[model samples]
Target chain A: MSATEGFLHGLQLAFTPELLLTALIAAFVGTLIGVLPGLGAVAGAAIALPLTFMFDPVVGLVLIAGIYVGAQYGGSTGSILLNIPGDSTAVVATFDGYPMAQKGRAGPALAITAIGAFIASTIGLVFIVYSSGFVASFAITFNAVDYFALTAGGLLILARISGGTLAQGLLPMILGVVIATVGMESTSSYPRYTFGNLDLTLGIHIAVLAVGIYGVSEILYLIEDKRQRASYKKIRIKDLVPSRSEIRQSWGPWGRGSILGFILGTLPMPSATISTFVSYRMEKGIARNKSQFGKGAVQGLAGPEAANNSAAIGSIVPVLVLGLPFSAVLALMISAMIVHGIQPGPLMMEQQPDLFWSVIGALAIANVMLLVLNIPMIGIWVRILQIPRYILIPVIVLVASMGVFSVSNNMVNLYLMLALGAVGYFLRKYNYSLASMLVGFVLGPLIEDNFVRGMRVSQGDPAYFLSSTFAVVIWSVVVLIVIGAAVRTLLKRRAQRRLLDSTAK
Target chain B: MTLEPRTEHEAEPGGENLETPPEEHVEGRRSGSVVFATLSLVLAVGYVWMAFDMPNGTSGDPGPGTWPRVTGIAWVGISVLALIESLKVVRTAPADLFPTGKSLKLVAFFSAATVAYVILLPILGAYIVSSVYMFYVIGLLRSKWDIRGGIYAVVFGVGASLIFIELLQVRLVAFPW
Candidate 1:
């Protein structure tokens, strides 16, 4: 089919009544998850994964994608109203958004955020349409060696940039890969880590692990923290419309942030969080009246909100094109696709163009739904903030347990989920990168398969890895990243030593 | 726009604004890192030993063990590094890392309760177990036990069971005929 025809078909598929209803429900749930503290996109999606299994692959994928976009839009509401960021990506919003609320301009701040997110998501969707085809086509030519380099190099870069020291990130990731090594090996059907147990040979499910790590662990953490209810004044519908001056102030930041976010989101980084910080910095650096920022500048609120949503949308391109998930949330999406027997890489466009285009169409539809839902339902979201932990926590626990149990109807999986949840809670307390661990778990098998295939093709010659220019370039980039990290660490330590010595004198 | 000075409550880019652990609990965190590193070191050694037991064929005909072997070796090296880094500044009594006794009790109670729920699920069925579990947890989480918690719990339990078992046909254990 022609590109235009595929695009049109996708829109048709997404516009069906059943699919539209799915998108609407997903949007509402996603926003609710995002507005609630202690639940981010990853946890939200993981918990919702089992529900999607009842539908066809296209509908399941659209549900996941809708949740993703809706969460990005909803995260700002908590930041604006309570000075509490719903997630890390919403932290920047709290800087100006909360201040605006304190000044009784919360309505305008939320309006601008919704408008910016809508525009930015639209831009991101356009880019996804144009760029995915080109990227996928190029990826279609990748050999096993190239694939290995890409996956390995991407994991390494993610480890380096995923925060904390390299070892901290790498450890959890390596452990995840080790976890993936269980059950039967694909090529030889050899069970490596089963240890003579029949159940062990079946391997761990990605959904089980995701729900355990993100959903169950989050519940434990929230229980320990005992999140207090936030007080919020009711927002009427009329109060939600932005004034002419506020609208004028937001346009420039929104455009710039959208572009910046899209570019960064395509890379293997925590793009949503990083893009917001970068956009905030850019706005601060370029603003004419700098003093207006912390006190409640529309530009400050608009830029980061735009960047957060755009980056969330833009991150999907890599997953669809290369089957490389750069974030934890996208990793879950890839897992869902795999569960549905849909391979998400370059060949997917040829094999499942309808699914691919329909996802894009779903995202656009979800974005519009968010814009429409968020403004009129501002009062409801605020009430959600007031929900007591006693009520919220139990509901989440029930849902998570039920979700995991329903997937396999096995008691063992529930036991495993509980154990993993305990482990995840500790890991999180120590600041380990769960995102890195999740991405590694998803990509580990792909890396091993590619490596083995490349080795077999090349008769075990190690030089074959460097034979291709793409592989060579990828390895070079990996080396550069390592060296850069080492140098930065050394310089930081040296600076610390100098300060200590001077203080001693 | 002037950049706002970061406050203590503000979350970092890749982190959240969790409450600070108590002064006594701070030492436990430090020692907890050491314990974790030691455990990881032991796990790595065991994994490496197991990896060697499997057949690792030559480069041309790599066995299922080849990737795990390489990963196991890398794991050993990284674990050693982690251990060293963790030990560099270890100072504190090896107490439990929970910030408060209340928090510890809450986590322990919930964990135990969940374990019990799982055990009872297949026997008593999902609806009965889930309702009781939710009711108990809600009462525990609330400052004082109330009838409202019971209502919410029953609604949630039956509502969830109906949606998953009836509407979605999820094949969950339901009421015994």
Candidate 2:
């Protein structure tokens, strides 16, 4: 179907009463998830996944998409109100947002965040809707060699930018690829790591892995730390509307952030956090009086929040077009799609056009719903933080277990969930990149499949890796990213040495 | 490219930065890196050994084992690099692992209780098992337990029933008997 036709049909599906209610419920859950520290969009998706099973496929997708999109907007609440980031990406928001709250402008900071997220998501969605069709069409034309190059290049870029030392990120990624190879070898149908256990033949379900990592591990992490809940200042709806000066200061940052976020998100990396940081830095650099930064600067609040939401939408583009998940949350979405027996790829747009368009439409509507829900309910969101951790954490665990068990009604998956949860907990403690591992797990099979196919086509010529111009371009980009990281690390070490030497002298 | 995103004021997973003495902090980090790298090296060696046992078809006709072997080699190379980098850090200072006793105990108990709850689900059913598990958790976490705490646990465990069984129509594993 054409983009316009798909969109129109999606409008029809998304606006239906059942799906509209699903959007509202998802937005509500996403907002709540965003309000709590240590609970991210991935966790929210995992916890709420079981509930979606009862709904129609489109409605379920809409709900999950809504939660993912809404959580990004919702995270600013905790950041602005309590100096706690609801999402890790919102960490940048706390620099300016908390200060605004301290200065009696909490209302305006939140208003701008919500508004920024709304506008940026709309802009990002427009690009996604228009470009996705083209991406899918172009992807369909690509052969095995091109596929191999793109996926391999994407993985390399992901490893480099997975938000830690390259080695730290690559370790988890390698582990994920190894884990992906556990149950059954695609080529020979031979079990590699199943240890002769029949239950392992079906492989670890993606939902099981996701729920374990995001849901159970997060609980484990939260329980280990004893943190006092932040006190909330009573807020009124009237206080949430932004002032004209604040609104004026926000427009330029919003525009710039949306563009930057979309472009970065479309790239094969974890873009939300990176985009927010980049937007925050860009705003700081361009501001007339930089001292206002971290001191309730509206531009600081505006740009990062806008960039974050835009990147959230931008990340969905690859998931739809290439069936590649760049982040943990997107991986869960793909798992949800797979659960419903719908494969997410370029062909999905062609074969399941209505389902595809409805998801896009649902995300667009979810963005609007967040703006509507957040402004009036800002007071309630603040109050949500007041819920005691002892009470809340138990409920989360129960829900997590139920969600995992509900997927297949098996007890072994519960065991697997616990085991992986332990792995995730330790990985986080050691500052390993869980997101990189997740991306690796999702993309590992695709990479191996494409590589094997391309090799078969080339008659196993090792030189086929660099044969095509496209392959060469991809490899060049991969090499450049690696070299760039190495150079930066070296420069940093040298700078540190010079500083240390000067201090010693 | 400059990947040091964790500046002094940046919020990490647990919100507050660890406020160890400067020397201790540096040494502690080095020890942590070394430990992780050593563990990764062991795992990589095991994986590579397994890869060696697999059938390696000719380059012209790659087998299922071929890609795993390639990945295994890559893992070894990177693991060695990681070990070297970690050793460089360790050269600066060496510190033993620090443990917060209470927190570790609490985490271990919490994890164990969860495992027990899941194990008992088929025998005792979700309602009874989760309610007891929730009660234990909330009681353990909260300093002074009130009857209301038990009520809350019961409600949560029962709420799972209402949603998963009644609302969603899932035939959750109940009493095995």
Candidate 3:
């Protein structure tokens, strides 16, 4: 089928009562999870995975897809209102978002975020519709060497760009690789580091790790700082409507962010978090009023939020086409699809074009649903902050623990979550980048697999790594990015020292 | 609560009305850095030891240990550099690094409660264990006991069970309460 015909068919299928209803429910649940701190979309999908067991596979896929998109929209709410990120991508939003709230422009900040996200998601959907086939065909030609280089390039850039000293970032990243090696070794069927525990042999599930690190660790931090629990001013509906000037200023950032997000999100990288940071930096560099950033600039809010939503849509391309997931959330989405017997790959496009297109259509519809549901409901979401922290914290804990436990129905998961929660806490305390670690862990097995395969194909000749043009190009980019990051960090530190010296004088 | 629009000058970036203070450029204390360095070093050593125990086939036909051993050696080098850098730093206690006395006690209580909640979950079931855990956590956070807290705990516990069990149909291992 032609792309146009498939899109129309998918749209027709998406509008049916059952699928529309599923999308609506998933949107609500996704937004709810995003609004709540520590309960991310990964948990929502894991919790919802079993709920989809009885439904048609397409409906199940759509439901989880809706939830992922909704969470991306809802994530900015906490960042704008409470200075707490609803998720990691929202961390960039909090830089300017919370300051806007303090200045009584919280409504405009949030409104711009919604508008930017909706616009970007639309463009991202279009990008996927047009470019996914191209990417898939390109992926078909990729040898193991290309895959190895691509994965290594992603890890290197991620290590360089993640906030903190290079050593701090690389430590968590290397630790993640170590953690990923815990289960049976893929080549020889030999267990690497089970340490005699049967449960360890199965390896740590992503849900368990995410919930423990992102969810439980957040709770510990909040508990450690009671000041973070203070309530904010209740939001009014009038506060949500953006002024003409604010909306006009946001358009440029929105466009740039959408393009940036789509390009980055389609690549073999952790798109959502990385796109937001990169978009914010780009906006800051290009802004007419550069000083406004990190001080409640609407461009700061608009760009990152747009990138985040666009990246959410762009991330689906690889999963739908190449069957590779670049981030933790995408990994869970793949699992959800697999459980429903829908194997996502190039063959999926050929075998079930309707299903593939419908997934895309569902995401587009979900983006619309998010805009409609979130704008008028901003006041309600902000009111969530008014709930007493004492009451709110425990409910969050209960939900998080239950969600993790439900994934495998094992007590070991709960314990593992609590243990990793402690590890995550200390990691955060010492300024290690958890996202980098997570990227390392998620991409570890794939990297090892591709490398070993490439080597075996070349009869253990290391020279084969540089044999392919794609490998050479990818490695070149990796080297350039790492060097660029190091130079930038040195310049920034020197500038800071000069400022300090001038102040002293 | 009415929010008044600030003066235009105050709203401008880098103006006096900034909501939060500029980030202070405080250097980290030696103790914290030392702690992190030591932790990394110890972990790297253990990892290298484990890697050595596994078979290391020739470079031509690598075994399970190849990737890990390379990572472990690099990790050791990095940690030692971190250790050396940490030794040159002076001591200072930032708020995030060191909690207040009251917060310390709360941290202890929170940790203990979490451990207890995990251990008692299967034995008592999600419904009972969650309620009691919620009740205790709320009491500590609020620094007092109240009927409202108990009510909140009950609602959350029952709500979780209903959603996870009856609605979502997740098969959790729980006592038949």
Q: Score the docking of each candidate (DockQ).
A: 0.43, 0.33, 0.32
TM-score values for chain B across all models: 0.78, 0.73, 0.77
**What is the per-residue lDDT of model 2 for residues B1-177, given as tens digits with 9 covering 90 to 100?**
011111222223211122333676576666777787788788888887887777766766777787788777777777777677765532222122223677777777888898898888878877788888888998888865679889988898887767776776666765455
Instruction: List model 2 lDDT by residue over A59-80, tens digit each.
Output: 8788787888889988888778
Q: Quick one: how many clashes does candidate 3 have? A: 0
Chain B, model 1, TM-score against the native?
Answer: 0.78
Between candidates 1 and 2, the one scoring higher on lDDT is 1
**TM-score result, candidate 2:** 0.93
TM-score of chain A of 3: 0.84
Candidate 2 is graded, for docking, as acceptable
lDDT for each of the candidates? 0.83, 0.79, 0.76
Off by over 4 Å in 3: A16-18, A37-65, A78-109, A228-249, A267-304, A323-325, A334-348, A351-355, A487-505, B1-28, B84-94, B166-171
Where model 2 places Cα greater than 4 Å from the true spot, the runs are A50-55, A498-505, B1-21, B55-60, B90-99, B169-171
**Candidate 3 docking class:** acceptable
Better of 1 and 3 by DockQ: 1
Error of 2 at B96 (Å): 14
lDDT of 3 by residue, A1-505 (tens): 7777777778887888888888888888788878876556765565455455557888878887888888888988888877777767788888898888888898889889988989999999988888877777787788888878877677766665563555655777777777888888877988888898888877776667766766676677667654444466766778788889989889999999999998888765567877898999999999889888888888898998999889989988878987666665676676567657887777788888889988887777888888988898887777764566677667777767777777667788889889888887777666666666766776777788887787678888999999999899988887776666556755765676688789999
Give lDDT tens digits, candidate 1, residues B1-177. 122321222124333222334657555666777788789889988988988888888989999889999888888887787777555532232233354788878888888888898888888878998889888999888855678989988999888877877887777778755
* lDDT at residue A61 of model 3 (Cα atoms): 83
